[model samples]
Target: MVAPMGIRLSPLGAAVFCLLAVGVIYHLYAGVISNRYAAFRGRTSVDLRDLLAVSVEAAVLGGKEVKAVRDENHLEEKSKGKTREGASEPLTKGDLQSHVKMYNLLKSSFPGVTVNSEEHDNLEDEVTWSRQIPDDILAKVEGGKLVPANRVTVWIDPLDATQEYTENLLKYVTTMVCVAVDGKPMIGVIHQPFTGFTAWGFVGQGSNMQRRSSYSTNPPNVIVSRSHPGQVESYVRSAFGNGTTVILAGGAGYKVLSLLDMPSSTSGDMDKGDAYIHITFIKKWDICAGAALLNAIGGEMTTLRGGRIDYSASPLNTGGLVASIGVDHRALVDRLPEWDPERH
Candidate 1:
């Protein structure tokens, strides 16, 4: 004979179930509600940059194999086989792995904010201008033009040093993001994953966690990429003369960080001080974050010909750039050759 019994939940069981439900609700609130910073949109972008840096660093440390992917257009459609113009090669999977993480995180954090990340740009109208505007950026009015922070674009580079990261040169790897309004950068965030350091700033807000010393060296030590040397050696030799010292490093973000006097073990070394020069047409994601930081320290990042960067234009920086902490930036720029070797 089979005995039929009614299912019953004991008081202890009910209490446990209730606690579990409460825990789940609390976690959801923490992720969605508590993290909802609709008003401080600029700060939100900076925070997300830090989150991506931490996430990517954790993935690397956890022994997860990072597959490399290269998409010249820097679009989010690597999986869909779509890329922006001038993309000649296939996307690398490892780079896409980090890029996807950053894209999703930003998209989730600032629901309708316009994101113009290197990994994704052609977002639907469903995902634009849904977040609050930062007051500092909103208050900015230049040459009779009111800054439209509400309709700004957020540029992100989830992982900057793809090749260096693959080669285990972790120090050079960084996560970078910047907010631009009407083609002008208003805020920037740069995070070095391996070093666990982040630098962020908004125009007129001074700096976000960056320490700088008022020091300059004669002959000026220049920072150049170890991966892409280009015509840097000859240019420095001719422009600054043979007395100029060149420091070889990987990643554009890292090179700019050094220019900002970012706190590092080697920061105390006065030898590698002064400028960061790139002769090749670089992607905007690689320069925007660093440009914001440099601007915060009373520094300037301009084309070698002393021209301004227009973010609203194409993603490529055609004129090349020279970033310097010194006020004598014009003198520095005058030293460089007129044409970019990669371009001309």
Candidate 2:
């Protein structure tokens, strides 16, 4: 073979080659190479703590939309249908607006994760919200771990108490977000629009709120839905005693707040609720955030049958629910009558 001739590139050619090489390296690092490294190391691409922080912000954004709608007197309401108990299921402009805001924020922040929202309507253009976690909140969740994007499901109830909102029961209104990993709720954020209060928790981590001192009241004061109190009052009385106090409330989020001793904005005092009971069909989005918060604080929330509610399953939770803090959960379950789907 003949001796090879030497080749040289011009300055422009050299510069172009360097730029193209850098672009290729960046693409590999941003996608294929990084993904393979993560898989090999069994590490998740998304941090659970960051996701939780973003979710808290998303809830606050949704709540702002809700409050704006009502405060501006631009509330518009319609009934989707009647509930199983023949109660009107209300949908409002605030609900849809809040849903859009929350959904867009989550989707934009974590494009790979799955987000489930109660309202199906996509009414407005997508909005961009900050993914940056505040320094204080980030410090609190510093030790939090990571989870695979596919394994995490974000459940959102942009407007938890639409019926109450329509009736001007603003104290019961809340925007909630729950991050469930492998069907177990791991993080929760609840924001009260009118009160400008926000509470958040991460399982195995700390929370922004503390368990109430009166959480273990004997013959516990049971909280039930004022809108759909289907035999829950009687069930609570039967399980504990005829003298057991039943506190009727509007929203599932509000009931959980009461149990946590979060002062009611309207009353300016802690709402009296030791346990929350529900015998009718409830949506996962309505209760998932509360369940996660309870779990974070060493509390328990389960089916009246003492079964774990799986968020990966159907959105509807047909089984009865009972949640309490600083109480014997199993004993409470053992005392309650078996929850029959056909019968209450």
Candidate 3:
């Protein structure tokens, strides 16, 4: 009665206060000075930890101890459950075939798509044009760079390393889709589609990747492609500068995912930003899904030229693009046009 003038408190409120206090105290004990220092609760989520190791932690909602938690369509895994037509197709071959199928589909869907690629007539387009169009007619040279100049989806099997996708072949593949607009990639879809996983970004729209444990999975492991092509060497050199060690990963999507793997890094810790390996010699389709996924998760994807990729072009979007996690991955690409990975 004597304290009736003060705000009333309930057990819930007391519990909340206790949690807040304890968290602060623990944070202090751990020298956790910023939000980035706070530990993340899940394996795939971006959190305080800086190393995003390949992990599949338990579900967060039930606080239960399960084997793993997955967001998106982690159900369509090749090892596990759902099965669809052509499900067993290898990533490299499947993606190549899918591009043609999608290209043909797009030709009917949009009526303006041009196919490029002919290695496999399984339905995929020719190297730079659909089975419907001739290669010479679609091919063009811009500033000495071989530009297919076709506004359509282009397929790139950057690194078909088996080690990366053996465990989760459907979830991890070095495949991309480019959709150009005005001579640039407007929409790019880099999908580990078989796993129902993906990263996508568009010009002016933004970029991001999907979390298999769901986008909500905490403390995700960021992966880099084990092998980046010669075209990408210059951009990689630019992002890492003179002495940055490149961490080889499995797929292109994984390359972009590497930044979100380990948390704990932020604005002040600039090196954390620099550690990212830049994929600059990218095409529209090559980074579409990854771009969208990264953009959704506080990242970026653009041309080494520092402009947004346009998607509404013809044939396909075959320009040089770069994908950066959270830093100026292009800072290297932006300057050294003469960047030659062979020199290294």
Candidate 4:
């Protein structure tokens, strides 16, 4: 003998259960199924101009984090030791905080795109961000239409010149972001937290900053890193005579800004160099944004051997970098001695 069990539900209860089931199903589709289907089919196209605008916002957000850490006097240093080339690698709380902010902003804005950041620790953070683009940034968009999300790569430097930042040289600190499409850097945004100055550029479109009116390479006022001078000074001297002015500075972003006609308040009296040269090993995150900016304003940034640096390649750039505006880049490359990994 078998006993049969029967279940009964009221109309209201039945309706409520149905509604809950519908909600669960809807969430499942929206959160998981939809995304999987999208991936299976193809990623939706993203506008480069919109991406640039978002990158600018991300950079500004990172700069705010940096400034907040410094203003709060939380400049705690976490020594990353030295690189293979013997250059000091300094990390700070500001770097981590800024990196988290920038990484979140970019990932949230475009989930499918690849984001490469300078700081790689404590990356799992949940943050909400608004998708609204600033009116000023929106107005600058022109001609850059939709492109596949997978074809883009973003490089971020949350805090450049940590050593100088630790020394309280606030003017040299910058947070930068770059958008590279199809392995080519197409957009750059650099923000100086201390000065509240931001410069953005879109290659082939235009830039908010202008070239230095006095920018020239006649005597080649070259900017070299203060932290890692290496043999760059001697190379510059050999390339453009001993009398050529060599400006020692901190931060690749600041050096690139020196090449631009920025306000004296932001640039200070550092004798804005017409060219920026670095011989030692440098990370792509350190230089990608500056390279994009230079490319936007009819400037050139390439290896000392005058070969294009592919953004999608390895993060480390062993080849020396040289950036110049309002001058013949190839001519400058020709003057510099051939880059030898073993020698200068």
User: Could you say which candidate leads in TM-score?
Assistant: 4
The TM-score obtained by model 1 is 0.65
TM-score of each: 0.65, 0.85, 0.41, 0.86
**Judged by lDDT against the true structure, how good is candidate 2?**
0.85
lDDT of all predictions: 0.62, 0.85, 0.37, 0.86
Worst 10 residues of 3 by lDDT: 50-59
lDDT of 3 by residue, 153-235 (tens): 43323222223444444334434444432344344444333333333444343333322222211221222344343334444
Off by over 4 Å in 3: 1-100, 117-171, 205-225, 228-245, 260-322, 329-338, 341-344
Better of 3 and 4 by TM-score: 4
Identify the candidate with maximal lDDT: 4
Candidate 4 lDDT, tens digit per residue, 196-282?
889998888778887877666778889999998888888899899998999999999999998988977766665588899998888
Model 4 residue 192 CA deviation in Å: 0.2
Deviation in Å, model 3, residue 340 alpha carbon: 2.6
Model 3 residue-pair collision total: 97
**Minimal lDDT window, size 10, model 2:** 261-270
Clashes of 2: 0
Q: Please tell me which model should have the higher lDDT, number 2 or number 4.
A: 4
Q: Ranking by lDDT, best first? A: 4, 2, 1, 3
Over 205-246, each residue of candidate 2 has an lDDT whose tens digit, in order, gives 778877867555468888899998777778788888998899
Taking every candidate in turn, the Cα RMSD to the unseen true structure, in Å, is 14.8, 6.5, 24.4, 6.2
Deviation in Å, model 2, residue 267 alpha carbon: 7.0
Name the lDDT of candidate 4. 0.86
